[model samples]
Target: MRTSLACGALMGMWLGTALAEDDVESVRARSNPAQGYCERVRGTSRAEAALEWAPEVFASVGAVNAGVAIGGNDDTPLGSPKMRVTAGLGYDFVGIYRGRTLRSRAEAECRRYQALAALQGALARGSRLGETEALQARARALAEALPQAETLVSSLREELRDGSATLEELNAVQVRLDQLRSLARDTEQARARLGLEPAVAEGQDLGALLTAFESADDQVEALAGGLRRARAWRVSLRGGYDEVFDEILDVDQDTPLFGQLTVGYNIGHLWQGKANAQAREGRRQETRDAVDSAPRQVRQLLGELRLTEQGEQQRLREVSTLVSDLEGQLREVEQLETRQVRRFRDYLLLELARLKAEQAYLGAHLKTLQSLLGGVKS
Candidate 1:
């Protein structure tokens, strides 16, 4: 069985380099692309699942014969009796069977690895979309939002001029308008992080740059997720072969003229088709559970993104108010209003708001990665 298994390992198979870094045999071809690996795994699974055969071979070079004699003539003597003799040689065959149940199963394991690679790749890509790439997308949205904000701010300002808008209306609009400004700045920071110049330097708006930076971060998280999945699938692949063994061997009969006989089966199975099937099921269940989690993860990411946007708007309001509230005014009878004091206070407040927006973007990016990775794991 050991020898047979060793021989079987040499069977032709394709491999992919995707798993090379991990130093594992995950599929037929090491260089296989994601879809290709998945297809191979499926094929292997089907072939193994349908396995059911045991070819029997036998051969012999022995012969058998018998002879009889005729009755004697009446004249010669009634006492004379007929004579007969028989002698022969022959060989029988014990079954020599070859089973595909386990071999097909081994192949199936390879296929499973292929599947894992594909899932891993997808997860990685999706995660990438969430961060650096995703951030880039958000940047675009920020750019669009900036114009809308500017228009709203201008319109509100005009309304305030007319007596149509009350103090409350003006205050509300002012708050929203300020929020827009802060978000615009955040967007700029995002872009700079990406190594891309902001779209517009002069009043370029805040969040545009940040959006680009966020996009890159999206990529980082996505790649990380995919790698995680790929690693996990590798373990499952090995599990498939943990208990495979063979139960057949060739031997020579001890007796003499039995004519060079040569076959029989010992019947042993360490890692066989049954084990393979179980492993497959295990992986399948694992993936199914992952799939179940995907939608929820994605929804959560979306929610986070929305919240981050809202947060940015909120921060903008705080910033605008901060600036507008103390519009370079010295208090009457101000004895000691050091520049350092005012600068320090304003810096702290701005820094806090800036950090929040950055953190929101980071959170959204992380969620995107989780959702993407979750998909692959499934």
Candidate 2:
């Protein structure tokens, strides 16, 4: 079992916002690992990490209302009292509706954030499936070709390190590595355009990753050389040499070349064999640990999402049922407007209310299915 939702590493500021807002949407947004949630991606995320920041829709409403109450005036006579009350409340003024838009703004941010995450997860799952097919294809092409390619790449790298690999081979591998890097970068940009953050690569380009892999492979190879008088000893010498040149010009070109020597020894007998065996087993162990973790974490996220889905589904059902109830209530409001023309604006506002209820109901229920599958098309 993994840890609880409270301690996953992205909840501090979100929690603060939660306490500050303390509303329904706030509760929904702050439920799980919304940060580092991009770890679900194959790479690091390239999106704005602000849903975890001081995310609220309106900052001035409270202050404005506080001021209006303090001053005892309908300062917002031109607009809604709610607007006049929060206008000068001391916050970053964005536009005309800044004071009145906090709640709506916060909800929008939350929706955008969840949408970004879902897109990333969907893209990654698709990419992973593609990689699976590619791996299978590679396997078929390797009829004993696996070990052969490994040896070819290894010997080629060894030659390169020893200043013996031909330019052609080095250039070819370098090109391949560059191409992979370009592909990764392009994938990240595509995600970003979709409002998802770019996932960062843990290591460098393909060249760097391959080089590191080769270095490790070399170590593993040397280790597996087994119990024997391995000639893997490295020797360095330090000395001075003198040479004379033109005596006619009296140019004594006698410069000494001095350096140092270093030697290393390993009882290749047990050490090599043990290291080789352990390296293979250790790699498999690490992979097993990772594989075990992936779907578990994915499912956990999915479960949290499912609960939200159920709750939203319930909420939508209630809203729709209320919609039916509101149909009669709406006619009453209209009838009152006919008797009292002054009630026209309020009657229309009620109509908007009913519309919003229906719209929200549909969105909530639709999200249930969307969040469960972890796919939302923008």
Candidate 3:
């Protein structure tokens, strides 16, 4: 018998573990949709594709040109046509820099999209989890209050029959009971609709989150700087070779190789570049200012939440005190039938008030949890 019991217990534990694992998997599937689908719909894929093609685009910066010519001399119209082939190779020094700048910009854009997607998913999951927890808290509070409400209503009914309590009093107590039941049912249904369990709250470092955002923005600024530099004066060098073959003369000739050097400047850009550069510089400074102030902004937000939480806590304490006083008064007046019924009704109302206070406190806590979740790495 002992052996059988031990084996059965082990089997139960194993089954429980497997079920728990399955639940976790189900939750993950519900929370995180396919990344590919999100990327396609959100335009992340477009940026990624651009980044992927950057190398091919960069290769075009170094250009190659080729041509062929075929002609016959007037003196030998019927002879085999003379043929010439020419090719030139050139590299634009400024174009290379511009290509690199463009590739960097593409990379930055891709990262921005990826970050946005992750943040969106995290916020969505956090909202669902926070809401589920809030509803669960409210339901628990109502459950605790329901039995007291029912007892108070029953006592008031008995008093009404004895002519010690008025019908209006009984009706009022009955209504409170009904309201509690209705609220409980509604909270449960809302919780069920979420289909999510409360997640264990995890602490996230604010500094680290800020750093991630700053790094992404810095990449964009660096790319912008590179582009500005790439727009400066440019120089290109090209060389070409030509060869001719004539069947009528039964001879081959090689033309002298030619080389060319060019300097380029955009006259229109010369007047506009300075203003644009200044504008970019101003924007970069703004970004820097924002980064510098981010920590303070985050701290201020957290401070406000803390203040709200403290206020909720104080309210909960006051409600608890009222509940205690009502309970004491009820015990003292138990011998007085009508008075006992009234005190019990008062106790029930106080209980409901306490529950409401508790719910408010939980709501404040949920908001804090959501804020922290927002900063968490997805």
Candidates' TM-scores? Answer: 0.27, 0.25, 0.47
- Candidate 2's displacement at residue 280, Å, is 11
**Tens digit of lDDT per residue, candidate 2, span 149-266?**
3333455566778875565655554454333334333433332232222332211122232233334433433333321223344343433432223333343335433334556565
**Lowest lDDT 10-residue stretch of candidate 2:** 84-93
Q: How many backbone clashes are present in model 1?
A: 62
* TM-score: the better of candidates 1 and 2: 1
Put down candidate 1 lDDT per residue, 1-378, tens digits, no spaces.
432432233121112222331243233245455455546655764554343232223332332222223466544433222222222332221111112333333344444443334333333333223445445444444444444444544554566688644566556555654664566555545444432211112111112222332333333333333323322221110011111111222222243222233333333333344654555456444433555543334434334545554554566566556544443332321345663444333333333343344445554554544443332222
lDDT of each: 0.38, 0.38, 0.55
Off-target runs (Cα >4 Å) in candidate 1 are 1-111, 118-144, 152-359, 368-378
Instruction: Report how far residue 210 has shifted in candidate 2, in Å.
Output: 26
